[model samples]
Structure formats: structure tokens, C-alpha cells
Target: MLTKEFDKPLQILDQDGQVVGPLPPNLAPDRLLEWYRMMWLTRFLSNKLVALQRQGRATTWIPSNGQEATAVGLATPLLEQDWLTASPREMGGYLQKGVSPAAVAYFCRGYPPPPELVGKDARCLPFTIVIGTQTLHSVGLAMAAKMRNENSVVVGTCGDGATSEGDFSEALNFAGVYHAPLVMVVVNNGWAISVPSHKQYAAKHLAMRGIGFGLPARLVDGNDILAVHAVMEEAVANARAGGGPTLVECVTHRQAAHSTSDDPTRYCPPENLALWETRDPLKRFRRFLYDGGYLDEKADKALTLEIEAYMNEEVQRAYDYPAPAPESFFDKVYAEPTPRLARQREEVRQETGAKR
Candidate 1:
């Protein structure tokens, strides 16, 4: 019912910081400030990662520049016992779920994250780089929770491009059939690499796809922190109450290149980028806080400086950490190395003068 009425991206706060729709209930001023800080922190970390990549201290950094609110909003509401399976670009979710900044930096450097940073007991999985595969992982985890009578939900996130993958469809069908406690979040950031949404699917909104699977679906303004948090809170609550999975399409823009390896100038026009700039999530939320008298210029400057110092310490620590041994890759492939693989490993060790 709500999904049908608000099929377009739902927005409570307009870009100018005025309420255009009814605000979500019980969102106190303190909670709003917390959400703002989370968004700001996510953006700050993303920007710093981009800089680290450009400086050659990090590798394959995926920019979550314009999607911080989507990441933080969807994740912040989840209970600590709940699990999250997210795409590589969902750094805000990872951080909110207790993944440390140093671990994120380690991830950017292509190194294995430390145990604590990898969410060993935090119920967060490593960032899923294989796109829609995490959808199935989320379904399986939720199914397991249901079997164990655990009151936890699995929140799976993927890009809109992933919706086209067979894995996404299969996971949705299974989750629907089993009535699993899961929340599937599709971040529709306009472009899936070089392909735009128009080329990705024929549906007016990706949320419609969940209708056939008998799941409640809604589209939320990914750029609006309050609206995103409100929608996701409802979705998570429903799943926890045994109402089955909910598909949420977060409509936002990809304000940066797909990754450090991408050249957006080849496909993304200047006009398109210029337009989304006006709807920038951080700016919109900051304006909202300012207008409400929750945040002032002095506080904003102080917060920025604090976040900068925190990131500087974490980034330097990550840089100083030792790189993983190249030979360890060979060790983990099998219980017992095959003769040919053993010979190859020895050859590499000999070539690199690496000790066992």
C-alpha cells in the first residue's frame, strides 16, 4: 500500500531542507544529529580513501562519494546481532556496523583486514565484490536465523546493475518462498559503471520487480538521510516480525567514477554531473541541521577537524602495517598442496627469496 502510493523515491526533506512529507515518528534532535555525523564521517573517509588511492598507498578504492547517506541510513538501524552483506562500495554501512577505519584502509590496500575489523563477532561479512552473489548469502543467513528461532535479519545490498544478474532473481525467489527475514537493498545510483538505469532495466522503478515475488517494495530517496532511515527501519522491523523480505530501491546518483580504474568522462556527461550536484546528500543534510539550529558553523568546523585528525591517525597506521606474505596465497588453496602447485610455490619462493 505504502509502496504503491510512494513508488517514486520517497522524500521527507526537500533539497532546500523543508519538510515536503510527514516526518518519520520519534526522530529526536539528538538522533538527527547522530545521523548527520555518520553521513559526514562516511563522506570524509571516502574522500580520504580516494586521495590515498591517487597517492598509490591504496588499491582499487571504490568511491561511495554521493551514496554515503544510503549506506549509513540503511545500516545504522540494524541491531548488533543482525548481519549485513554489502557491495564493495558500501563503506558507510561497514563503518556503522563497527568496521574500523584502519580495516577499511587495509581493504583499500588489498590486504586482509584484522580479525576485529573483519566483523568476527559483529555479524558483518566481508565486502562482496562479486555483485549479486551476496543476495544468496543474505538469504541463506536469514534462513538459518529463522531455523534457529533467532530474531535477526539479514540486510543485503547491491548496485542496481546487480538486479539484472540471475543470482539476484534466484535469491529473491528463494527468500520469498521461505518467508525469510531479509532486507534486500538495491542502491540505484543512476549508473552501473558506464550503463545508465534506462539501459539496465525496463521497469519504471526497480522496486516493482519484487512485486512478482510477493514482497513489499518501496523506493526511497537515497540522498535523504531521514527518509532512508525511516523506510529502512520499517523494512527491518517487518522482516524481524516475520513479515518476509522487503525490497528497497535507494535512488541516488554516482557522483564519482565507478572506481579508481574508471574514467567517467568517457560516458557521464558534464550536465548530468552538474544536476546531481544540487541534490548532494551531505549538503542537503547539513542545511537541514543548520536550518533547525542543530549545527552551527563553529561546530561544523570543529567536527571536520576532529574527523580529519582521526582519519590521519588511522591511515598512517594502515600504511605502517606489514603487507601479507605472497606465499600465504598458495598455502590456503588446499588442505594438502598438489605436487605441481608445490613445485610452483617453491619456484616463486626461490624467485622472490621468500622464506617459508
Candidate 2:
């Protein structure tokens, strides 16, 4: 039942970082720097987190490493009040959306995620570790926007593997039927754990899935930050104008393992890694910056130092902050603790007393 109007994918930039079409006048030098800064900040945090995991400082870790473009580009076009629901690998989007460095570090360290993550107080949403479950959350948020007649749109993000989940399909169906103001962005990194993308789904392209649900869809080379920003701008503008939902599938590569516990060597070859390295999102963006005279060798060096210092500060802050007390678990689980939870809390208290 979907319209076939969107035949060719939308893109504003080529793989070499040149714009395929006109750059939006509004995104002139000053505004473009904002996007670059966000991406740099996220990349800095991602590298630090990987080090933290390796050093055993972090218990839970999911690094966005090479996928910086997809997150930052999509987030740049969103309003400050719009909602964002993301998978674990999308800490970059939170950074781009203005989540504080300390809060992100705390959450990734498993030391009580920030409150802003769960509430509308901040545009960011707490990540759903259960894969594609947040698709329904996005649908629900969009549905709420519709009921309230608000201009707010909900942008949900997921990995390629998430598309394999039933919740993803159901969310799209419901959102499409109601013409909800939602944008589903799939960061298809071509690998879902040890399984290659081909093994995970039979579809030729993830973007095509939107057609079945009656939604507008497009594919983009995720490494091209300019293209990502442009497409997201168009998509977000459409949704806010009450044009309903759009599905964007960004074809990028995962430069790291599924998690700290995963090893890509089990399935990926050395040449495959090398191929993606040449297409590193950061390098591509840097090329664009250099070619446009937006950055010089001195500026690049200074920026690198700045990012390193910032990340070191975040690491220190995370370590200095105290971990949440055992009671925090009890408090977060329910508004009013049930009798069973109350009893369990008492038991834990008793056990601690006995040990002391």
C-alpha cells in the first residue's frame, strides 16, 4: 500500500566528501562547525570508553567508534525538544543532542544512568539494551505527539540486527497506519554480531522494508556525513510538517566488535577490516574539512589535543563519582515498592547486617 514515489535514494554528498548537490545555505561555516564539534566529541568519548573497558574500569561498554557520522548527522537537524530513542551503540547521538559528558560516562560505566535519560527533562532517552524494543517506544512517543497535536517528532535508532526483531515491524505498522510523526533510522553496519548482514536478512536493502509498511524510505552512504545531515533534515522537516513517518537506512560499517565481549575476527577477515578502515567515517569527514579549507594541519593537531583532554576529564569525573547504593535498584524498579520487593530489600539489609 506504500507509495513508490521515492525511487532513487537521497544524497547530498559523494563518497569522497564532495557535495553532490547544493549545500543548504543555513548550514554555512559556523553551523557546519557545530556538527564537526559534536562528531569529534563523540569520537573522543568512544575511544576513551573503549580504553576504559579494556582497563576493566567499565562493566558495560558499547563503542560507536567508526559510526560517528550516522549519529551526529541525524541529530544535527532535530529540534532541542524532540525525542530520541537509541540503541546502546548510539551514545554518539546523545552527545550530539547535548547530553553532558559526565552523564554519558556514568551511564556507560553502569553507575546509575542519568535521570535525564529516562525523562523528557532532556531530549535524550535511556538506551534500550534489548535491541529493537525501542521501536515501539518511538511509535508510542509519536502517537502521543499526535494526540497532543504537537509538532514534536520522535526519531528512533537501531542497528542492522534490530530489523530482524518483530517489534521493529510492529512499530512501523502502527506508526504508518496512524501516520505518526516518527523517523526510524537503521544504522546498518553490515554486521550483526558474528553473522554477516546477508545471513541475517534476505532483503536486498533495509530501506526497502519501509515500502511494505506504507512509509517513505531512503538509503544513504552512512560514511558521508553531509549526505546524512541533508537526508535527516529533509526527513525531520517532513515529519514536523505532518507528513507522517519516514524510514532511513544508513549503510555504514562497524569498525569494532558487537561489544567488549565480542571478537570480530571470528567472522571478519583482515582485508574486510582494511577496506572499512580506508572508508573510516572520521577520515572521510576530515578530508572534507581539509579540502574545504575548514581545517589546517595546525587546527587538526589542536583539535586532537582538545578532544583528548576533554575525554580524560570525563574519565576522571566518572571514576570520582560514587556508584549508586543498593537501594537505588529498589527505588528505580517501581514507584511504590510491592510487598515482594519490600521483603527482598529487607532481606538484603539483614544480610548486610549479619555480614558486618
Candidate 3:
């Protein structure tokens, strides 16, 4: 029987990889391998990104080292028509949403993103590097959907530290009061750069903030892919059915520090390292697959080789990408540049002694 706790937060698998309850009813056995592949691909992609940053191919990168399950699982329930607003660590979500591997890797380069990823027909928004702005964008999208009588639900993801921002609160409050069909997913990976959660919020649980907005909210085991998917699927359903906003707090770990520039050892203790390792999502999920007879040593070895080959191809493609043209910056600013911006653009060109 499913634990009552599992109903509210809904964890499908325990740390030891034992099924805590029945699998998601709609999920087919044939599809489980696909989800596992996406999760593994996320890990492989993240490893490549870190290497790219180290080799100076990309300017900055926030490694989603421990965040694959949280991103990939929650993304599984999203229909192609549903909108998704994501923070920077959304490569996993993008991949699930049909973003190509080459497109994902090339975007991080100091160049225009490949046409496949950022084309006019793509559903995803450009990644928001600013902390909490995507919350407002998500709220706006939900509001527009409501106006259009569109039944699609929208999801916005942010870091745990983003909750401290006023924009995050305002977005939730507005979303609740308006009963906007949106899901606010907070991936609490335990640190915002040098600051830990203890220093960031006084509340015991981040999901409790949804109460203030008079919306349904709950926390979940972020590392458990099945658990995160089950809960987020329900949350998405509720939103699409016009039950209004839901706040989902996903408790996961960063495993690595904040980004390429960060050094977690400066703040976190070695014991903290040992603790999270025991709860490693990849290890835990692998065991779940093994116990269920869905995976074996042969499958694992072949999958590793497959992913490694893909990563190597992506790294080479990223290396060959051309630098963005100087004029490309001015192109995305607006439909038509304002007079001040036009003047500033010319001024910058003149100052840099560049061709018109």
C-alpha cells in the first residue's frame, strides 16, 4: 500500500531503490527506459558542460550535476502545447521537450544558438540567467492562457534561493489571487552560491509559502525520478483543469557547487559531502531499475558507450561554432530599436572602431 505521506508528497521509490508504492498508472514499461535514457543523457551533458567551462569554451555554466531527475521527471508530464519557463539549469528539461543535443551544447558557446533550438517555432523561452524573473514571465503566460481560454498549464522553475526574491513572492501571490494555471517548481539544491538554505529562509519548508497565497502546495523527494514525476503530473493536471497555482518544493542536492566559478568546499563540510553521496540520485535510481528487472550490467555498459559517443560529438560541434556577429546583439533587443538605443548602438560601434 502507498504510504499516506506518499499521497501528499508522493515518493514512489525509497533510497534503497525499493518501490514504495505502485508506479504511476499511466507510465508504460516500454517508456521507463526512455526516461532513464534522458536522465543519463542529462548527466552526460552536464559532465561535458563542466569540461567545456574548464577548457574555456563557454563563459559560465551552472552544472546540473545532481538535478537531472528533478528536471527530467517533472518535465515528463508536460504536453508539447504546455508552456515551460526555466532557469539556467534547464538543459535536461529542454532535452525532454525535444531540444536536440547539438542545439543544447551550442547555445552555451559565445555565439548565436543553433537554429534548431532557438527557431521561431520552438516552444521554450531563452534561459533566464537572472534569478527570479522567470516567475513573472510564467505568471504572465498563465494569465494569457486564461484569457485565451487555453487549457494548457505553465511551469516555472527556480532555485531555492530565488524564493527570497520579492519577484518570486509577487508572482505567486498574483498567480493565486488570479487563480492562474501555473506550477511554481522550486528545486532546492541546498545552496545559492556561498549561502546555504539555513541562511536564506526562516521557514522550515518552502512549499508553505503557497499557503499564504491560498494555493495547494507540497514538498517532494527531488532525487526520486518516479516520485517527482508522479507529484508533478498531478500538479500539472490540477493547473490545466483550472484549479489554480501549485507550489512544489523539490528537495534535492547540488552535489557540485553553484556553478563553474563556485567553490563549495569553502562553506560545506566534508561530512556534508559524505551524507549526500549516500543519497545520490543516480545510484539510487540505478538500483530501482535493477530491482525491477528493467536494467542489467549489459544494458548499462552499452548505454554508457552510447552516451559517451554523443557527448564527444557534441563537444566537437561546440568547438567548431562560430563567434556571434557584433550586429546580432542589436537584432534581439526589440522589434524596432528605440531612438536612444539606436543612438547607443551607433555610439558603441564608433567607440569600438567597428564597421557599420
Candidate 4:
């Protein structure tokens, strides 16, 4: 049986980005570069989305500003067939899992998700706006996968605040009892909205909750991409091997506000935020690449320009797309609309002067 590691958070990179612990044996320089690119892309996209939101092109968005390491690391190891149920802040994971920037942009604007995000073959569920609900969906998916004797593992990610929800507890109980092939990742970014972690739970570490459910658990340095990837890889492997669920608590900080609607300065102290800035995952990882000679100023500048150009084009396309038709709301809810819904649909059609 896999055991819980209740010690300090696992970390492979120091704040200086130098390897402070043993590196993963399988990680190569090229793979590290790829990981760096993904993290950079995720960060850039998140920043751009926030900018778009400010400019009224996008709706409220959860910025994954400081959590790129945790997002990309956890996602990089998953196979194409593996399923992911993620929160809004996990746009990094979504992008890493082959989700398109255009699709994400459209979704953020309250439009229908791009076709790429729909259907079973997408291998990723839409972002769960409701806290802790995705855990149940992940458990259900894992249970079904186990029933079919498939090797696929279902991963569910949520923030620290989600752990307090009843659905989270129930899902953990079900996953434990059935030994479902699920991995629950808690991105413990110290705040569940405006509430800090100290007030959210009494436990010293959230990973302890998983131990109570009879599953292996680990506390990981969410800023250390290598550590996050290493820990998740083991958890995924164990789940695929039929060892059951594991809960990984990624300890990081939400550098940005909870969403575009929130104001973190109202609750979070500036000093605390500044302290975390010193450990910014992107900055740390960039230093590592530079020190290793994998990235230089010229290459970094070129990559930044390339990604920015791509993002600008995609954002413009999303902005140019027509708004959702009024009729579309009444459609897709059912194969055949109910009597009341059918009447409402006609009312919308008449009100909007939309035909067919």
C-alpha cells in the first residue's frame, strides 16, 4: 500500500532554481525546456486573459498567475486517455491537455465552449465553477474506468477552500471505499477566496485529510515544478496500477485575486504577497534554465514574442466571433424540449426575431 508522507512539502528546486534535491531520473534537458515552455505559455495566457477581462472582452476569470508550476507539472505526466476535472484556475492544465487558447478565451466570455472542449474524446471536463463538485465527477469517472478494467486515471483539482465542502468529503469516502483510480489534487494556495488556510481547516496540513480516508497522501511544493511532477507521476502510476486514490496537497500561493471580481488587497496583506513573489515559480524556473544554459536572453525574448503573437491572434479571433444566439440557451439542454421549455424557446425566438 502507498503510504502518506506527512513530512515537509516535497521540493526539488530551491528559490534560486538550483536543484536542492535529487532530480527525477527520467527528466532530460529537452523535457525540462518543454515544461518551461508550457509554464511560460500558461502564465502568458493567464495574464492576457486578465487584460482582456479589464478591457471588457472577457468575463470574470481566475488568474493562475503564481501557480503555473503546480498546474503544468501535474498535467504534463498524464497520458492522452487520462481524464481531468479542473477548476477555473487550472487553465494551465487545460491548455497542457490540448485545449485551445481560442476555446478557453470563448468560454471565459460566457460563450459556448468551443467544440474542442465538448464530447468524451476531449478527455477533459469543462471547468467546475461550483466548488468541490468536480471531485464527485472525478470519482464517478474513476469508478467507471475501474469497472471497465481500463488503466485510465481520473484527476480532480480544486483549491484549498473546496476541502470544506460536503461533496469533497463524500467523494473521498466513496473513492476510498471503492479503491477508485482517482487522484485528488488540492492546490492549497493559502486562500479559499478571501479566507486564508488557517481559518479554513484545523488540520496542520490538508494532506492529513486523505490519510483519514485510507489513501496515500503527500504535501508538495507547488512552486517546485519538478517536485510536483514527480509526486503526481507516482500517484498516477499507483492509481493506474490499481492502488487506489491519492490526495496531493500542493502548497502554493494565489498571487492574483481569486478572480477578476475579487480584490485580494482587501484581505491579503501586501507583505505576504510580496514574500511569495520572491518564490515566483516562473522566475525560479527561468533562472534554472538560464543557469543550465538551456535558455538565454535572446532565446527567451524570441519565444516571448512568438507566444505573444499567437495569443494576440487567438484573442482577436475570439473577440470577433459572434455572440451566442438567444435560441441556443433553450437548445442542448434536452433531446426534446419540455412543454414549458418549448414555449420559452418560442418566446425567445419571437423576442429576438430569430428564425429556425
| lDDT leader | 4
Report the C-alpha lDDT of model 1 over 75-112, residue by residue, as the tens digit: 97899889999976888887788777778887888766
* CA error at residue 8 for candidate 3, angstroms: 9.1
lDDT per residue for candidate 3 within 1-356, as digits (tens), equals 11123234557788788888668886676677778888888888887888888988776878878788898877888987888888758678877877766776776774557675444444667788899999999999999999999878888888889999999999999998898989889988888888889999998888778878887887888889998888788889888887888888888888787788978888888887777677777888889888878889899889878987886786676667666655467767899999988888777767665553
- Highest TM-score scorer: 4
Model 4 alpha-carbon drift over 4 Å, by segment: 116-120, 352-356
Overall lDDT per candidate, in order of appearance: 0.85, 0.80, 0.80, 0.86
Structure candidate 3, residue pairs in collision: none
TM-scores for all candidates: the values are 0.94, 0.92, 0.91, 0.94
Candidate 2: give the clashing pairs: none
By TM-score, the better pick of 1 and 3 is 1
Worst 10 residues of 3 by lDDT: 1-10
Worst 10 residues of 4 by lDDT: 113-122
Candidate numbers, best TM-score first, in rank order: 4, 1, 2, 3
